[model samples]
Target chain A: MSAKEYRFRLFVAGNEPNSRLAEQNLRALCQEYLPDRYDIEVVDVLTDFEAALDSNVMIAPTVVMEAPRSVTLFGTLANKAAVISALAL
Target chain B: MVENQLPNIRKCHTRIEGLDQILQGGLPTGRTTLMIGGPGSGKSLFGLEFLYRSALAGEPGIFISFEERADSLKNNAATLGWQLAPMEQAGKLFLLEGRIDPRAVITGDFGIQSFFAILDHKLKAMGAKRVVIDALDVLMRLINDSRREQDELVALHQWLAERDVTALLTVKAPREGQLERNYDFLDYLADCVIQLDNRMLGQLSTRRLRVVKYRGSGFGSNEYPFVIGSPGITLLPISEVGLSHQALGDRVSTGLTALDDLIGGGFRRASSVLITGGTGTGKTTLCSVMAQMACARNEKVLYISFEESEAALVSAMRSSGTDLSSTLALGQLRLLSAMPEAMGAEQHLVRTLVLIKQMQPSFVIIESASACKRMGTEQAAFEYLMRLINTCKEMGITVVTTNQTAGLHNLDEISGIGISSLIDTVIQLRLLEENAFLRRKLLVMKSRGSSHSHSVHDFAITDQGVVILQKAD
Candidate 1:
């Protein structure tokens, strides 16, 4: 039997207000809504700025939900309900 | 002793009190400064104030705005209280607004050479010493190639520098990057860089200006908070000093003795008094009474009615028994009626300043400042109003502005846009329904530099105008 699991990675630039808020929001959603079903990776672009640039991340606090290919979303993570729904978790 | 050497080189004076100190002697003369900021940071206003002050110094200036139409710019400037139309007519100030297509430039249909030629001709024709290019970002967007954009900017800067013209270029900071990253190119090219920032402090949004770089001159590097007030923008560099009280001893009677008594004699000259009330609270009637009082003293008065026409204002004042017809006939009272949407906020400001200059009035009244919000941009409208108020104060004119508060019971709604902070004297009028009858009450919230009676006076608008009733002790 095979289970369909989802994987997500949030690329953030340093610990800016927008970036920190996005990471906190995404982790909270994974714990409460998608517990035991998804793997979450939080990447700080400040430490790995080159990787963020190579991934074509023009803006910070970007959430990339990877099922097969990466579906990237940019903007502040202030909208928790919308982000959770958008990632289909 | 023979003094051959000149005293210290003096910085160009803006002529507006308190602003020169913040600029550390008024925007580096004969150099281009880029003012970059987000919306509501007062970039356009900074440019307008620079030109207005230069014009007052007998230095002809030109304002080239791409974001706003010509008439709109005029209106907004008028609202800020800088009269630019007359200056334009007298060849002291010039305004140029036109459309440029980026695609056409990319296709080689539009040449940058022609643009410079046109600008040079206008500058020479007007003999303009100062030039303001509002929103350089808009112009950059019209050029498809990055190299061409950079070349055009550099060329323009060099051309202005060669002509010995001090120019002001305004740009919008990118929404998502640090200040250094957002305006890297502009910061590199400009001789001076001024950044206007609006930040939310608790519940209030404060506007602060910082001089990031000034090539060869000493300037104030600390953030200076500024308030857009009557007469124009005044930077508060020294907050410990209170000067709003330093004004000529003059007063205008408030028609109603009871209300006048509450104000301690009457409204002080050069003071900004705000009359806020709910609907049908006689705010307009009270303003008319003050206008009539000013005109009765043989002093010239300028009345800006935003919600009513000249004919309607005259009729309303006439019905209230304040004979404004004779004042109009004698050229003592000039009524300028404007529909908020008739022109942009900047244009409105320019017109108001023009009227003030033309009439040389000692008193000015803006009936219903709330209507100004209905114009193109609310931030522009507020900025213009503040500037206009500041200008009036500088001219030693008593300014009585009326604002209609939203929500019948919410004082918070009245405080929206931070208008209360700009006012020197606040007269709040509330409407109460008692036994199915509406009663209007006026309360003096605070008056600077004067001991005002803290009493809520009952007032009524009849054919004889506004009558203040004795409050029950």
Candidate 2:
């Protein structure tokens, strides 16, 4: 079987400090865990506000892991170990 | 032009009629107003009403409910005849779901930045000025620490002011014995703080809202009785009625000749008359005689009976030889009957006030004002009667209220009666316990302006109406 693909959606306010940090942290965590086998979609709520709202993302630095089981994480994901534990990677 | 005006705390109108009067213009503009109350105290309703009204008044509003769903808020608003969905669809109002799934474990540290981020975007896009956050404590749950909760409220207050948004936050007051969880910090954080109470008066609940604190504005400090009725939440600002409402009324008869002689040659028109007595003291009969006499003079009379039905009142008065059928038929007398327990004190007052406005009666007879205690509490009844009397005097309508004193209480006590100052003339009726024979006596306890007899006289309710017997003769 092909390696299980990891899909994730990150909602953020446009170019906010925490939003930028959350994006970098999430990408770093995913690259180290499931390198070349994960998908990350960054949605800037300022431009496409409804997309974040549609996913029920009320916080800026929120990550929704859709593949290998769905999980939601809040904040900038500064604690990469916690994010890794949350994604079960 | 608006900016050219001197900067001050601009009042945002709640759109509630009397609420604005007591609020001295409405809530302090663009400042967080903290509404704290126990459950069912009408806190959420008040917040929702403020937004609904501002939206309809051409200013947009956004309602962020953290605990209740937007659909549920819409359904509740519909009961108030507020078409919230249409307003929402028109972009005049918006209901944002502020709830987060409780089961979702927060594995990392988080802040409420995204909520504000979304709100900041929506506020400008909708051009909304009013923002109501219902169940603010639920949102505060995000800040697990009490100190952090306080900090968040401070941040929220500053943010709202910077955006010039009038924010109303409804927080569930700590329940009894949970004083440690009090939101005293909210009082200091917000520019205004209001407390709502749904007090249990006997078996019924009567709601009262008080402005606990207003930073740079004057508000009615006394608790204002409010009702969640049609249209929306309406507060009875009885304190707003100044003493200047005193009417320069003329003299009017009290139906009985000798009784009028005792009460300073009759009661003053547009003045309030209070009758205090125990059961079977001929108070209702005396009121009937006055009602009949008013109708005899071609003046309209509105007789509000709390205990007796309209037909019962008519028949009872007929037995006392005061036939109200002709006057009632002629529209000179309108008889309204309702049990005080049927509604809250606010409703009883509001319904009667509406009738008084529609009828424009010269005399309003509210039988057994003490019965109003059944509507709520002693304080509620006192406020109700005070507001009614003030309204009557303001409209030049004479008012007669009866207080049914219990047999155990002394006549001087005037059971459940506290509005003695508002009363122009106070008549006391008592049953003289003489040799097992109950003899009724009428005494004019107080007459504001007129001077007359100070002696008590025996009275009888005979077939020819109430007769003040000449005990001296």
- Which is the leading candidate under TM-score? 2
Error of 2 at B123 (Å): 2.2
Model 2 chain B scores worst on lDDT over the 10 consecutive residues at B1-10
Kindly list the per-residue Cα lDDT of model 1 for residues B1-473, writing each as its tens digit: 11124343335566654566656567656778888889878888778777777887788888777676678767777776788877877888877663332221111112233335446666878888788888777767655456767777787788888898788899887786443332577788887888888875423456778889877666666787665655777665543233453374566676667777898878777788888877777778888888887777778988898899988888877887777888888889888988887765655665677678778998889887788776555675576677777777767888888888865535444643466666778888878777798877878888877789787777777887777786724
In Å, residue B322's CA in model 1 sits off its true spot by 2.0
Which candidate gets the maximum lDDT versus the true structure?
Answer: 2
Give me the displacement of residue B422 in model 2, in angstroms. 3.6
What is the lDDT for B272 in model 1? 84
Worst 10 residues of 1 chain B by lDDT: B101-110
- For each candidate, the DockQ is 0.01, 0.37
**Residue by residue across B23-65, what tens digits does model 2's lDDT show?**
7778878788898988778877787888778778788998888
